[model samples]
Target chain A: MPLSTQSQAEEEQYVLVANLDNARNLSNILKAIGFKDHAIFTATPNGLKVTVEDSKCVQANAFIQADIFQKFTIKEDLVALQVNLTVLLDCLNIFGGSTVAGISTALRMCYRGYGYPLTLFLEEGGVVTVCKINTEEPEEPIDFDFCSSNVTNKVILQSESLKEAFSELDMTSEVLQITMSPSQPYFRLSTFGNSGSAHYDYSKDSDMMELFRCNETQTNRYKMSLLKPSTKALALSCKVSVRTDSRGFLSLQYLVRNDDGQICFVEFFCCPDVEVDEDL
Target chain B: MQCVVTGGNVKVLAKAVHSLSRIGDELYVEPQEDGLALRSVNSSRSAYACFLFAPLFFSRYSIDRGLDFRCKLAVKSVQTVFRSVATLEKTVEKCHVELDKAKDRLTFTLHCKHGLLKTHNLSYQDTESLQAVFDKDSCANVFRAQSRVLVETVVHFPPSVEEVTVAVSSERMWVRNHVEDEAERSKALLTELCLAADEFDHFAVGAPNSITFCLKELRGLLVFAESTGLPVSVYFHEPGSPVVFSVTDSVLEGNFVLATLSDDHNLQKSDSGGGHAEPPPPPPDDFMNDDIDSYLIAMDTSVVPGPSTAPPSAASRASPAADSRTRKHSEEEEEEERDGNEDPGRPPSKKFRSLFFGSVLPPSPQTSTQPVTTQEVLASDSEDEDE
Candidate 1:
């Protein structure tokens, strides 16, 4: 795999199209999903194009989405989650009528959101060092086998016995090292666990990871923030139970303490890898 | 005229003159040379199919309210007339007239070419008078009745839809005669119905029996299923019917869907689509009341079965066997009419006689036996003396 230079990263761009009434509505919706301060772009009659600094984009989007299921309206909760996932699936329905395009390109964007938080460093030979990503369930230590070259582009992890490790803040200070392809100076983080071992995967030549439908089901959860009403980081305390449905289906349920001492429940089942629209 | 193919039913030709009239307006009929041709202007192909198939394939459109009303009118008229004869028979028997061994003679004749609308004025007493007219037709010479009976009935539809009332009545009569037998009467009634159908093929009323509403909530949900990249279940049920349609996510529940019927609020009023007009006063009550009088007269005459009940000496001997069978059948019919009339002598007093036909003039109790008195008796003879 050859590394991408600063010049190469500058040239790459991605286009995003949404049916939102306006950019403000789009910003609000994205912000609810933990996105903030990202550049906002308006769609022209033609389309909207987005340019991003690889490291910054990967870092901002890389946050562990342990709670992605919260994005749906109660009435259309399941449908919303399913659509979000389907959009990520190599734009499955994207090029429905076109037969000429290879299915692989469509397959690549599926799990791209999983890899983020890549390490960034400049090199004189037009090469840059980008960080590797590790995805994991709170109960499982990062498994090295996930990054094996022989493994297929999509992988599913499961556990017979699973339990939540201590919260990330409660753990001893330590940094986990991940390896990228020797030729590429950068690697992207696919996904992360708020607590416990992280998982990593390597692509042959680019920072982009082949899209795959991935999910982690966590249970017995609680969230609390120590900061004041204006500024507070959400604190989650719950037992983690993880599993993935290969057919792009996910079922995750969480328990959190409310103002009352009683535990409240939240359930999530994601149908990821949804077919995307090609006319986007 | 050339025939135009509409769908499966071919339209033979476009009709120039619309003959059938309901109220003031002429009801348009498909020219008999061709079949009927009526279509909605604003609808698409699917809407057209829904309208066409509604009455035939689905039982939703089957009742035919108008025809049902017609049937009720026919049944009531015939039954009341039959009962009137039975009453007259008992009355004659009490009097011990002792005219013939067979029975007291009676005969009944109806001019039903006008169909159910002819009964718009008919009632028990009116029917009795009408029967006297028939009896005169049967034996005016032997009975010493010089005057012939005339029971003329006409069903008048209101000029405007707002006027719900109709008028009916009969003319002059003296004696009651022959009664129609039951099976024969029913067949006659059916024949009249056929005639009415002929009239109705051209009658086009503007209002629809029921309105349909479409479910718009299901629109975005169709695309939502595609997000899963898997099949989602769908359920659909139509209005006014119990049928349900369902499919998996791969197939759409209403894709090949026939759209729901569209309705116009303005359609409820008359086709003129103008604000409702002031209703006209109801048709003359004599129209329907007179018809009822004819029915009663018929019943009174038919109640007594005898040789005199035969059509006439010449015609009776010509068809003696048939006349005897008819007489025997009339006897059975009297029993049935009695059972039916037992429940509601109120049928004579129902508001529809006044509402749809005309305001039925309540018969003066004095005329119950005679049904109708001579106009000369009611008029002063002083004018004759002056002449």
Candidate 2:
């Protein structure tokens, strides 16, 4: 058989296969949600969803549509598996991962049914490397159930505005208190650190603010350590949507544009810290 | 104390700090009215680097009250603050360094052009100041070479070669890989390169000498020189002495000193051979043999403990007897003994005959003389049988 025909024959045995012209497209998006080593991958006919959780209080998910891949095939309705994201990244960038112009690593990922390892073939500049990473039983990710209908307060702003604030946030502060209200101090981010307390306030009518929907004033404090990883997603995003439910559950959705000018989304869900009574 | 460093000079300071951090975990910062000096010494004391930046290098230089203010800070902490020097150079307008004596912390405030301010407060430790003093005039050999040429030459050497021997004579300078073991030395291919004396801008040699030092540290210093685009000047007095590499730019000067391996004890001992009145050169035919004999003697006496464990060689069989006789000759009398062995057709030169004996014979004067005569007789008998 010819080379192409051989690979086509080999691809038939695998239950799922994904091919991308540039491996960095997948690697970069996976990095935005890579706060942990192991990532759960759930693939359906629609697309692929990768979820990573830490401390059971925070969860990050990256969604890559099936259409993003040049060649994506599935033998089953749904294929799920878990693998070490760090190892997968290393395999994807085996060719030194240089971002030089007109050079990229092409990737072909395959997975045979239950007990088989996930195989990756990366080729760059006429050189090829094949890596077989053992997969583990996938762990079911927790659902925050943060429905849009239950969102008490929501606001959409350009990521550039929030990026500045997040970069300058005092890391010494244990928790970051966010207050969204229709009254004065429309959107406020407060931190009490060792040096001093700092407050970054933005008016509702600011040019950076794209959308604002507030039914009631809600104040929630999330652990700074848990929210810190979202900054990675924020740095690559153009727009961000901030939402809080009545139970003080916070959700941040970031719209990221890749090198090809294609749109992707990375969302983060974080549970608020224990509320302290103020009427004492 | 407060001072501000602006413009492209901030990158120079950051690079200096990053380089110093590689030498030691803690950096000693000395602030004088003129400029600042940063110093670090490795744990093994084999390597030391010092960077001196003059006052003219900084845009705004000041001293609070004292003429000299010294403090020790963690290298990692300082490196973390200036991790993004490239970005800082473009956006940052000025960097203000303030020493808060009352608070026992040092604060670095970065003022950006867009009114963005970032502050970092680092804790320091109380440590004694480091002072490295070396006299360049006392060194016997000194040479100045272009950093690019030196770095390009050193890069060709194999990484497995740990120490490199640098031999400088009146005619030329040569660098070769230094092998420690005799057996391995013979098996391994030797890599040596020679450069004409004219290749160096300034070359001076009082005496012909060869010194072996760690190659890895020398490469590091050469890299620093290459980055700064400065000529590297090397100074060395003799074998086993520390070699100093110095580089100077318009704003800063750096000196790196590395210790050399000691290989001159046996050579010195042989030269001083037993208070002899006269030292005569050996005959031409025996010249190669004498060199091998002396090397074997030195290897036996200085490094090896016993002849039984010596490398399997024809000359090693006679080492035990030679070792005992050589022990009697003091350093002061070594020259006389070495000359006494050089007399043509002497019994001492017949030491090569003992290699035929498989067993260790008793040390007897007659037995020592018998082996040479028996070897001659055996040769004649073999000739007769052939006839």
Candidate 3:
């Protein structure tokens, strides 16, 4: 409440500022895509977006819509800055991120523009702490150019099913092959590990499958290590949409519901692993 | 060979594979007339375990007659297929295991809920089944203790403890960990526990003896026993012979054989700080005197008394525990008296090897402290062949 009482002139100095009654709302979603260290933060009037990339082969984006925050303001048309995700998470959870019901940490995040540090004021149980994380030049995120119209195969399933499938995925396998088709063997996940090959299939009419649309059957292979981190998002989400473009690029969008029952989105885009026998 | 485990038994099969994985890197699966046998032997060849799954354990079972079906597969490969036993129990309805001779591979198919079918095909190598020759019925010392008793005692030992000595007498039994060599004493963490002989369901001690074995295999046994809520039956001879632990049910039986260490006896007479050349009690009645081949315990006196007086004590062990006791008692009555005075556990009435208790730092009484009795034989002998 004290943060909101700050003089309007002082608040105007910050090009971007947002406040939430519960810091976990921001910290939890950030954690969904916190697998990488350097995260590019883009603040626009719509909300805040955090993007993390790995080996230029995979990209993860976490979006926090404007309405979710208790107070949101943006003086600039677009503000992009990069910061260490691990450090930011540590500062946000400095109070240990109490999970007790009705106990929440108040967070006020502010950025003064380029060449300035991102300041965070966190309060828990009436005790206030401040943190200033230095920002670095933002790097452009790779655009997989995987649009909705180009999607050849798509399936929506409850998180429970995918969670079981992913948790048991063979880590020894170098790549995971996914087959999505309209007819027989509707959707399948296969892995070729040291011991042998394993396959898990899902019929279209299964109770867990919420939606299934396939214009053409597509089989693509993705690096297991690249897609492994997305299990964190899958664990927190309630529903997930899996799609593959005609180019064999993969996209996984998770509908994550935060602790406050507010909906948020985290999406992952990964380029397929090329087989040795396949001509370039 | 082909077998089908309908619903109920799939979980048991998975757990058996998991237990075999802990024993060795390779799994030897043998198909026989009566059932299927899964076996594994540690790389050091010191520990070997086998599980026999009867035909009743599987709903549908068949194997070609007069043909060898013994094949070895990487334990990890098969273990991966059965990973997550808890999940498998709930989702899987039936599991089929079939051997494909043409393809030279083994396939595991699981039919689960919601029309979901999962299949795994593992390639295996043809090999001879490793069989350990030991008579479980003739073991001198045998006892059946509840898994709870073993687990409670093992929990007191820190993970750093690699070996544990099981010392048993007619009246009492004890467990301890600490190598007696002075060089290893600084790093050796001392732990001792005394378990009453009555704690077991059945207890028998033909000869008061001590056997030191690795905890790694014991842990593997505990995993199987605790899960099935079955007591583990231990049968072993003297310190040098292999110890066999068995768990059984109406449909399944598992046997684990672990090699006992002989150097623990050597670790005894080699005591550095006992001050007196404690050749142990002159009488061999209470101490472990192996009539069988166990020269290490009998040969270590030379290494210990190398710089000290009484170099002949090294050659004394060559005479066996019985013959050596008479020789030592006559040769060093005075030294044995000093050892009896320093150690409260080692009474002259019992000729047991107090090799370890003699060096035991005054029982500090740990929160879970169990005393290292003179009769305990400091079973903490570590396996020299652990490598």
Candidate 4:
């Protein structure tokens, strides 16, 4: 269904419009970045980007390209608004076909100018549920400026492999240490938990490693609590790219495949937790 | 002390761990001369479940011969390693577990299909095993069937059902939600299923008997049995006796013993006993935990709706020979003897209530106590006074 088919009189009132045959394709990817309640929705001609931040330390951005949806339209050049992501997700799954097949909830999302509620038109099995979630003032997201040129070490691995590591991670540990080197242990994840210190090392030549590029031996620690939310994205992704900048800032890009087989991306940028005194 | 379970057995071990987690918060991992013993008892101490994975069950099994090896880890922590059995069966090639004396921690390392290794080091403390004593051979009423039959049957009953009654005569076995009395006949949601004795693979009833036991632990055991592709066998005597559900796989054996109600205990609170007296105190709660047993002994006798006053089955505490015979099952486990269990036998004599409870009867010395007959013991166990 396209916006042209709907009442143009009513559509003219909305500054932003997006439509999907199945709400799950949009909601599933949104759930990956929904660790927090507040989400900033940024719309451009290219696509819709949803950003969620935690404590100003970790920020997750999910990019849903304009092509992933059946109809994507924006009256203005840049339309940005903030709303409770948890509420949006609940509305998306209101029809409850997130997992079931043959029953899909068609979603039509619309937004007016500032301060207007974000209206959702969801239909499943001929029944419709309209949810109007209130919107809030959009806040500026932090910019890490972590470009590829500044990335000291980067590794792209099959999410299947990283999912195993993250699922079994010792949650008791306050921080997760990542080590990447050109020498012996090519990649490692270490945690010092209540029981003891456990390290998982993945050799550079391992089959699960899609690409491994390391120039210097770099080790950095990130708060496990901040990095933990990325596990949800890792579980839904097919491949995950892990990169650490020279300043110990970490960037994770997950390639998530929607139910329609279209490609989407969810990325996380995290600042270092602590620098241990290990000169000895 | 360490053991390695490889190939398909890893999933079985994980399944065993998952099953034990359902029973208790803590798991007692004891390595015996026979095999590895994992046991758990519920909080109220009404149900006890054990899995004895024989040496053959593991690809590599070894223990420190000189030092005593007994430690307990939180079941929740151990479960994180074996979170999903269906997935573990596919991705996990082998699971190596170790208890390093120097480290003093229980470590489980799972080697996955992609040469991925995940290790979980869980802190554990040295603890005593919770052992339950129940006589399966002496139980005149026995029922055996495929695991799915019971699993499917259990699904029909609502989850709120706390106690379930299985009544057996020579011909029929009636399984129904335990109804306290005729007054609740209309308002209560009752579900009943009747299976002929002949329907079971093996069924025998030497004497007419009915046992009302907690249904939570039984459902857990049945699901475990059904998943492991093993048949379940049930054996028990009259009410108040611990009903044992035994599942034996190729190299693994599990016994789930549940507490049952005696049906005859008349409540004095006049509250309609409306709450339906909490079955019986776990027969095994006495010897399983010393604190609970002694506390039970310390409780006022009349406050508890004792199993019975002078109905029948009461074994004498004076006979040691009968004691050994009744404890023949758990004797191999060598469960440490606890206080007040002078002679623990349920042989229906003056010994009364000794099977499920240690006899601390007859507060006969204290005049401050009520003047009731000595037939009723404290907490769930009742004995018949000498006629």
- DockQ winner among the candidates? 3
- Across B229-251, the per-residue lDDT of candidate 2 in tens digits comes to 78989897655445778888778
- Candidate 3, clashing residue pairs? B165-B379, B286-B352, B287-B351, B287-B352, B302-B314, B345-B374
- lDDT for B266 in candidate 4 is 16
Q: Kindly list the per-residue Cα lDDT of model 4 for residues A1-280, writing each as its tens digit.
A: 3323578789999998999998999999999998999999999989999999999899999999999988898999989999999989999988765576777889899999799999999888777778999999999888878888999999999998888788878898899999889885788888887656667778788899999999898889999999999999999999999999899899999999988899999999999987866720
Q: What is the lDDT of residue B212 in candidate 1?
A: 22
Per-candidate Cα lDDT values, in order, are 0.19, 0.68, 0.74, 0.72
For this target, which candidate reaches the highest lDDT against the unseen true structure?
Answer: 3
| DockQ of all candidate complexes | 0.00, 0.08, 0.55, 0.32
Tens digit per residue, CA lDDT, model 1, A67-147: 221121121111100122112211222333232322211111111122222111212223322322232221211122222
Off by over 4 Å in 2: A1-50, A65-254, A258-260, A271-280, B84-94, B109-118, B263-387
> If you score just chain A, what TM-score does every candidate get?
0.19, 0.96, 0.97, 0.96
Report per-prediction Cα RMSD to one decimal.
32.7, 19.1, 12.5, 10.5
Q: lDDT (0-100) at residue A98 of candidate 2? A: 85
- For model 1 the local lDDT of residue B221 reads 22
TM-score of each: 0.14, 0.57, 0.78, 0.73
Q: Per-prediction TM-score of chain B?
A: 0.14, 0.62, 0.69, 0.71
Q: What's the true lDDT of residue B356 in model 2?
A: 15
For residues B152-232, what per-residue lDDT tens digits would candidate 1 score against the true structure? 101121112111111111111111111123344334321110112122112221211221212111111222222222232
With a 3 Å backbone cut-off (N, CA, C), the pairs that clash in candidate 2 are: B273-B333, B273-B334, B273-B335, B273-B336, B274-B333, B274-B334, B274-B335
After superposition, the stretches of candidate 3 with alpha carbons farther than 4 Å from their true spots are: A275-280, B113-116, B178-190, B263-387
